[model samples]
Target: MTAGRPEPVDRQLPSDEARELLALTRDLVDREVRPRSAEDEAAARFPREVFRTLGRAGLLSLPYAGEYGGGDQPYEVYLQVLEELANGWLAVGLGVSVHTLSCHALAGFGSEEQKRRWLPGMLGGEQLGAYCLSEPQSGSDAASLRTRADLDGEQYVVSGTKAWITHGGRADFYSTMARTGDEGARGISCLLVPAGSEGLSAAPPERKMGMWSSPTAQMHFDGVRVDRERLVGGEGQGFRIALAALDSGRLGIAACAIGVAQAALDLAVEYAGTRQQFGRPIADFQGLSFLLADMATRIEAGRALYLAAARRRDAGRAFTKEAAMAKLFCTDTAMRVATDAVQVLGGYGYTRDYPAERFMREAKVLQIVEGTNQIQRLVIGRHLTGR
Candidate 1:
């Protein structure tokens, strides 16, 4: 909710540079992001300029190596910046996350020649990206995706549709996964398809419940020809690469979840303090006060959990289970905190004139994106049980 100014967050940054980065992010959010968030979101307008501004600010490339026009900020620092941006506007924050996710396949697994050719532009933020994995029939079971990329002479001819793709129509590039050989995960391959591929097209954006400012659409590959060099990682390695990227991407979603919840909590607290009831502020009532307390607690806990998972990743430890846990807990927390925020505002919260209702709606998609909460539990369970 953009109803009130965000409360200051006490962040634990690793270095002076990181501290400066956070300050710069806050300044940018206050000046550019917060002011237009309400109006732009209301009109379902995507703020491409905002992303360009963030790109120029070196924010869009944080957590990547600096040699390729990246910021090279660690995951811990990068995630906190995401939290701040999301606190201002979820569409922007999540857009940044999806862009980073799109870059992961090449950044982490591409050949040296591939990196030298494409890394600079993608990291520079002038070009946005989309990750294509989930198909209409295979949202949760991504390995079952039916998109095919068959070899034809020196090029691969792709054919199939990718559903629920973020930045689907507008991205400069797409990191697409398709089946190249036998069925299932072993046959999947990752491809870097440029936006203007001959047979590539995007359907009209989906009318989503929230995050309207970020476009989501189904992308069609009608025999789109991609060069052999565009293959990311080895053939039959796409599923492994995709899973690895999700391990990190889930943390991004977790950070964004905390940001939304933090914004909702801030609005709820501010409203409770200023809006009078029963001849005094409703915040004075024990019932409402306890609810606010619980909301704050969950936000703090979710933030810590995500940060913990991020730290594990930064340390090069296995963090898939932790990432799943963070995604599950933090998104659930956002939903609860946003709902509580509306409850605190009472009748005003339900109205579109206020942002509590919007926050509630936005929180819902977090539970579904990346992987659903049910899928997160499955991941965690599999990790624990050695399945």
Candidate 2:
């Protein structure tokens, strides 16, 4: 049985406008998203209309520049919106994060002419985007990818396979990375490939552990021709762009993890307060109450960590290490919190009759995607030791 809605988080907004934005997001979630989350997810249906709704409302383009159809909001404000959306439903929220990641190369490094030509429609919300960096052979060692994009005349013909791509078959565009020169990271370059291009096709969607409605599939480019103008940044800059995009993407995952964790905690607290045991509320006991306290404490810590990293990004500071830390700690916290919530619910939590099980399944992918938690630790360690 669904517990009643939890009270809204009291947020400290940067301005009245930001407060209004969050309110709008919350209203949208309550009216349109939360009610159908479980049903849609169970049916393996992607809510494209919901994304269109977000797009039409300008939620999809919040952190980009306003001049090119973006909202120009600071990362701080944008991330809170993500967190709220995730609180209602993880798939929709993480879908938005992936869409934003797909747009990163063009927004951050595209030529002015490129932005003028493409950025508006991309950020306009009518279009969906996907990022392609991981290959079947290369997961963390992205530098060794064999996808090739060789220049011929005025165009580049691409041929390779990219695996574990989100929105693989459904996206309007794919921001792809391919090898254009010597082997390794320096040879890589980014290209924005349009959908329906000849020789470009997607394999069947992978059977996933969670987020079923959000398709993850392999993309194949069989001599898919792209104009030289479609190159983002330049040849040999793809690896750098991918890393930069992931740094910000990790922060998005961190925010989403907190959202899932907060939702689970809310469920646990509500269940404990109402479920009777020994003729008294279970929450009245110190042991169960202490668990709730720890859950809340960890959630706050995760929130503060992500927000601090977001603030650094907003200030134009290097946040690679901080973002890694947030992603690692927050996702780990989500997994622990979700599992404990299941424990708090006793046997009821294990069943799909409640949302706690779903939260646990969804929280798991947060640690794996963007970058694995192990990779995050590696990133932090490298930054710390300069080794």
Candidate 3:
């Protein structure tokens, strides 16, 4: 069955502006994103222009202050837009999320001069960004990262590798974390390193199971010197900044997960309603009907969970545990829903002539990125036990 654009989620936005923003997001997704997604994925082509288009349209800077060229929308509205984008293409949706995460430190903690100088270009459509946190040796255990940035007179000399960086080679800037002092989490600090720094370079992108249009690679900083002015927050503040960014970033991942699951479910439902089994549409049978029901229910539940977390964040509540819970539940739900969609399509899903297989592959990465679902569980458990 040919996959169609899934129906838009009936989002309960807070204002006319938010409603209009969602409408704009849908229009852009249909006109610019969906048509090129399958082709780009098949060719392993990165859609830099598509991101530039998003930037021009102001989708790039939602959920930040308007004074710094942000859209100034609430997280609830911003996340729904993310869900819609991911419904069109996971790479694009996740890319926006990562870009926003990369901007978090500078936008939230940078000096007024830094904001005045850099935020406009960063938040505007002129530049794309990457978050540099994970390393070859430190994946889930991020606090143990060995990448170092030593103060050398008027600048900091950065040297090390950051692994699994989205937009690694292509980003205009990198919000990098590096050790500046003692050998622990407290030693780490944040820096906004421009992409063309003398010693900064990237390895070839990873050959992944899906989302080939979104590049992931290792970035090398070979004594790359950044001006002292680029340091975000304070020395020894990177770990805290990273964790704060993650709480919101996890919600973005959760929204993207739901979008993928929703797409898979929509494709499955369409196929089931049309495909005949024993001279009758498969959707008429209780077995297939029940499966579709479960998929829809899971998508709805996941959407609600992520939105609840977003609302807490928007309201300035401590949402660390809630964000983790949403990330864990939503990603697990996406994997299940995508698998069920593939099963519903039988042989077609396996071949990827249909997107069910792609959905399944894409769903796997959501559980691992931002933070592993296992890591999410640990975070939730910590909140519960205060341990």
Can you write out model 2's per-residue Cα lDDT over 1-387, one digit (the tens) per residue? 664355778777788989999989999998888888999999999899999999999999999999999998999999999999998899889999999999999999999999999999999999999999999999988899999999999999999999999999899999999999999899999999999999999999999888888889999999999999999998999999999999999999999999999999999999999999999999999999999999999999999999999999999999999999999999999999999999999999999999999999999999999889999999999999997
RMSD (CA, angstroms), candidate 3: 0.9
Report the C-alpha lDDT of model 1 over 27-61, residue by residue, as the tens digit: 99989998899889999999999999999999889
- CA-lDDT, candidates in order: 0.93, 0.94, 0.94
Work out the TM-score per prediction.
Answer: 0.99, 0.99, 0.99
Per-residue C-alpha lDDT of model 3 across residues 290-349, encoded as one tens digit per residue = 999999998899999999999999999999999999999999999999999999999988
Q: How far is candidate 2 from the true structure (C-alpha RMSD, Å)?
A: 0.9
Model 2 misplaced regions, further than 4 Å: 3-5
- lDDT at position 149, candidate 1: 95
For model 2, state the Cα shift of residue 42 in Å: 0.6
**Candidate 1 ranges beyond 4 A from true positions:** 4-7
Model 1 whole-model lDDT (C-alpha atoms): 0.93
Residue pairs with colliding backbones in model 3 are none
